[model samples]
Target: MLGWALTFAVLAIVAGFLGFMSLAGLAATVAKVLFVVFLVLLVASFVIRAVRGQSVL
Candidate 1:
């Protein structure tokens, strides 16, 4: 998940550096979405793990 974010981020950077504004923008947007999804999923997973480890309420 994070890997994909990094990949798009790198692609965006490279594209921007090469002056491909449209591609860079698209890649950057993808990277942002991936990064956000990664964070949300990461945190949700931790919460789930913690809940599963706890005694029944």
Candidate 2:
């Protein structure tokens, strides 16, 4: 998930460099959304493990 966010971020940068404003904006939005989702899931996973007395690692 994080990898996908990074991929879209790079794509957005390249598209912006090439002057594809719409595509760049879309990719950047997608990257931001994916990154947020990834973080949320990561934190949830850690919380769940802690609740269950399991090591996060």
Candidate 3:
């Protein structure tokens, strides 16, 4: 999921550089959403692990 976010972020940057405004905007939006979701999941995972007395690091 995090990888997908990074992939889309790079795609957004490339698209923007190529002057594809609409495609770049869409890719950027997707990247933002996926990144947020990934962060949420990561935090949730850490919280769950902590509750289980496990090391998330």
Pick the lDDT winner.
2
Runs in model 3 lying further than 4 Å from the true structure: none
> What TM-score, computed on C-alpha atoms, does each candidate reach?
0.89, 0.97, 0.96
What residue pairs are clashing in model 2?
A: none
Candidate-wise lDDT, in order: 0.92, 1.00, 0.99
**Candidates 2 and 3 compared by TM-score, better number:** 2
User: For residues 1-57, what per-residue lDDT tens digits would candidate 2 score against the true structure?
Assistant: 999999999999999999999999999999999999999999999999999999999
Q: Which ranking of candidates, highest lDDT first?
A: 2, 3, 1
Tens-place lDDT digits, model 3, residues 2-33:
99999999999999999999999999999999
Model 3: lDDT to the true structure: 0.99
**Candidate 1: worst 10 consecutive residues by lDDT?**
48-57
Top candidate on TM-score is 2
Cα RMSD for candidate 3? 0.6
Model 1 — TM-score against the truth?
A: 0.89
Error of 2 at 46 (Å): 0.3
Reference-based lDDT, residue 31, model 2: 100
Error of 3 at 57 (Å): 1.2
